[model samples]
Target: MMNDVVLKVEGITKTFPGVKALDDVSFDIRSGEVHALVGENGAGKSTLMKVLAGLHTPDGGEINYQGASTHVAGPLDARRKGILLIHQELSLSPELSVAENIYLGAWPTNRFGVLKKRELRRNATRALEALGCGFGPDARVGTLSVAMQQMVEIARAEAFKANVVIFDEPTASLTDTEKDQLFHTIRGLKARGVGIVYISHKMNEIFDITDRITVLRDGQVQGTVETANTDLNQVTRMMIGRTLDTYFIRAKAEFGAEVLRVEELSRSGLFRNVGFSVREGEVLGLYGLVGAGRSEVVETVFGVRKADSGKIYWKGGEIALPRPRQSIDMGMALVPESRKEQGLVLMMGGRENTSLPHLGLFSSVSLMNRPKELAVFEKYRSVLSIKTTGPDQAVSQLSGGNQQKFVLAKWLCADPKLIILDEPTRGIDVGSKSAIHELIADLAEQGLAVIVISSEMPEVLGVSHRVLAMSEGAIVAEFEGDAMTEENLIDAVSHHRGNVAA
Candidate 1:
């Protein structure tokens, strides 16, 4: 697929002091293409891949390459012109090894000089067995596993011989068999012609590993087509330029009885023999894949880890929480999936990080009461309608879907009954993920109890009613209502296994 364009990118643009983040951005990238880019979350596709990997400079146009005209000033001048990138956070150096982080700082020294450790462990085990990358070049990249530190950052961008690589969202924390082993190392870097570029949000992995498709919405260029003549509803209507709505109604729920329950919950090696039962109008979901422990079974049902054995029943007696301030004095509310590292505060103020973990119920004898925390942040920022420019702003200048609706108005103003959430719409935007799935179906029609934990199988079959799934760390399959489709819930979250009988 190389009609020889190699790379163009004219009219580039970029800007920041008030956000323009690329406009007039023309495109090209051909030589051995894989392309794919797409967009939506602050759509500048990581600021035009950080201005084509020079880490931002383009305040205007031009960037040809191989056909001439270039100036990638940073990442070691685009790694001496071969161009690398690969981020979605995985750069390695987790206390080195894996052949000293694959010949880090160009090792091989000797000739009466020193540091050559047997030819740097035989050329880092022949560049990780020529990219089959099974690890063990003296191991320990912090005992590897965020998919083996993203295959040692793709064997250090195939030992820096990258012919314009890029990647970015690299299977957003892999695991559909490690995303088919990263599509066999991106089809061996497109049979060695290399020009990749990938960035994703997983439209079935950009229609199963792109060939050509470009999208990018606000901040320009929105069309490139050709991934086998496109589809995934036209690359999601050219990445959210419209025709959106992927169904998620769920509103009429209204139950109330059993607010919570669990029996054999054990958290030994993280999630085991877990039991369930939540009512007050349920949702539940859970499902798995990225380390199939589903955030250690809801942080051990909200006591934030530490269980080793179980019991938990809330409405019908028992309650024994070992921490998280007795699971927030037992109203229990989590929502964590690193929303700005475990949910907000970016130097504070979207109403003081939404009343910072219920500031001890707005303390009085020990101070804190600024007009009752600004009238409890204007009443949950007008009950999670939070667009904010005022509750004193700065929740890091908002938007990643209003910083996840100010972390869902800080656990719905900590008036929890049992929420949990984790991955509650990661990296937000389809109109703030349909307004946080209609505020979790209006907080389960005002009864609360939620749970959630997702990996987006159509948002756990549209805000789940009863999904479950998980794998390896236990609980295998459950689904409900016309068997939650998306190919049977992504094959019950990538191949189910044991304990599921609920």
Candidate 2:
């Protein structure tokens, strides 16, 4: 069963809009084994998956599924043949219940056309329980958290009894606990001789759950090796075509004046008595679980969420933050968690988004100095190594890595005294993720006080000079120097209780 090739694609090629998404890529998924497909952004990972799922027709290729050469005409047709793709992006209808979403468009009914609601709920519950989902089938998908919604998506796939399951970044938004459950579920599927195509950028997950690792770069197959035979450094080299000598390294910078200090900050129903401070030339990391209220604390500090009882000190002077503009005017910037929603203007080009904070700098008497705007954006574009044909290229047209650079460049243009980056490198590729880490370090080296809020332990440890672990709401432990280990940080957030002065 382990050697049974259930899905095979040979000479697959797909091209679109000046990019060769998949160029004669050949791969196979074996029954009872997890095959990982990994690559950098725009490396054709998604394109290959889309072709397999019938979302895109390949320019040229042949697909053999279960020893039969066939074409998956559409998503329904793929699912009808026991092939299911649990996408990274949740596809469930928010308005529908878990049961409804699981059995959507395929509800059982009597001759009178009445739905078998009881059967649907029972089947949905069975799937959810198999995945150790906490919520019941009757719960509305919209009311659930992103992690829970992800679980529901997987449950929907499992309910259909998929023989070949493709999981693309399935653990992206999941918690440590939920990730464990998903791994267990994947192993259970393998035991039943199901073929799994696991795609993710997280190297640890690929190494842990996958039996074979396939590397793709710029729409071509680099190589595929047994997961046990390959290492992280080798796989990364194949993906980016070079050794990442300093994937995550930052030189120490001397601490300067206090940039921001929070005393007894409390937000009703969100966080409680959250006290922390950041000094210039320091990258302070805030590490916590999904519901640990890390983002809420930063939001409250940045004036987007009002604090119930708190004292904010900027440069040793007490301040009342009534609006974000006031904070911005006073030399503070917050790069939000969701880049698409809150960080940058998608419709606007790189120049426009970069100039949003520097309107005064690039304007004279209500008229924008277009040349100045382009010059400023070009400077940061070079500094951040953002790849784009021109400044007029829309931010939405940029890749995830390039788009994140625009967000950072936009705030960097403000020349803030302090910058708060929330989940800075969530969805970007490793190459871009490494570049952003270096940029964060460079920003700190340039004497800008920075606070990074991240769920990834490696990221927090890699970029921060010191880490403040948050649990529920308050700071549980502070790790610095030799104390800053992933084990200690995880322990602090997972088990440690009671607040320490931050």
Candidate 3:
């Protein structure tokens, strides 16, 4: 008996100007199987998916759906043929009720052509119930959390009986418990013989959930293997075609006397009673799973958010900072996770973004000092290696790695004693990641206190002198000396829980 092939791409190729995004890629999805598509950033995974979903028509080749030559003219055409794509950023009407949002385009109508609210609610309730969701049908989508909104999107897909579904980084914003719930839903879809296309940068999730894996690199297929046969190392090697530099350069430096300390930091719903200290030339890494409150802890310490109760000491004296500006004034800097959104103004040029954080320092008699500013830009442009057409080129035009360097340059200009990095290497390439790691170590060696919060375990283990593991909203474990291996760090993050805050 021949197995049913739900979807097939025959030598599909797509190209953007100056970038061959996809090169003669051929892939097939069988019914009732989870097919994982894995690759590093800029590996053309998103481009291939977009082509498959009809967001972009391939430059060459054809797609066969359900054993028939078909073209998905648009998203609506794909939806009509039982295809659903769930993006990382959910698409839903927030102000509408869950029931209304689920059946938005095809609401139940009465004999007089008026919307039948009762039937709409009943049908929506059934869809959520089938997916094991706990949300009420009448609940407003805007009021629900991101996890719940994702569930609603799944319910909407199920409501239409999607035969083929694509999940693009579905668990990026979800907690462990929420991820478990999503897994249950995926299993339910599998039981009903639906085909799933999973795309992600994470290895563990792909191995755990997918039946087969396809690795893409440089806009081409690297390899495809059975999930059981391929190990993480083999798959990672295929994804980047590389022997990765997992061992970071630990510039062992003699730490000076204590420079920063937090005593019983408390921020309700984020973290509470969180306390740690960093000496000059010390690198303290905060490691945890998504929603582990690692970023929140550092954000509070950097004064991005007001701590409900806590005492911060700089050089062993109480130093209270109520806002980020206050913290900046007292020699603290933060390179936020979303560099484009939070750290740099993408619409502006690189030199402007670099000078933004410390513009007041370059001002003379309420007028800007162009010469001094240009000199400062030249200094950082050389130091960070920010690739640009020129210093006057918009930051948005640069690559992901170069854009991240611009963010670092902006903060370094502030001349802070303590620097905090949240997901510092996120979405950046390997070469740039290495550069950033080296830069952080060099900064710490120069007698600056450094705090790094990263989701990547190897980075945390390789670079940090001390590691703190957080779960829920508090630190659950601490590792020092030689106890910071990848396995131990994963165990600590996976099994951590803390006392409930009063």
Indicate which candidate wins on lDDT.
Answer: 2
RMSD of each: 21.1, 2.5, 3.9
TM-score for all predictions?
0.34, 0.92, 0.83
- Per-residue lDDT tens digits for candidate 3, residues 1-502, read 1157899998888987566888989888888889998776667777888877779899998899998999999776787788888887788999999999888778889889999999999999999999888888999999999999999988877888888889988987776788888988897898788989998766678889999999888788988999999787787678766655553766585799898898888888887788889999999999887777888877888877888998998888998655788788888899998887789888999888988878798898889898888888889889987656677888876667788888888888888899999888876655567778999899999989999988778887778899998877887788988787887777876766554344
Model 2 quality (TM-score): 0.92
Once fitted onto the true fold, the runs of candidate 2 whose alpha carbons sit more than 4 angstroms away are 109-136, 392-394, 498-502
> What TM-score, to 2 decimals, does candidate 1 have?
0.34
What are the clashing pairs of model 1?
338-342
| Cα-based RMSD of candidate 2 | 2.5
Off by over 4 Å in 3: 1-3, 110-113, 245-253, 267-273, 287-293, 315-318, 337-341, 344-352, 361-406, 413-415, 425-439, 455-459, 469-477, 483-502
lDDT of 1 by residue, 380-401 (tens): 7787766565777677766566
Higher lDDT: candidate 1 or 2? 2
Ranking by lDDT: 2, 3, 1
Q: Give the C-alpha miss distance for residue 65 in model 3, angstroms.
A: 1.4
Which residue pairs collide in model 3, if any? none
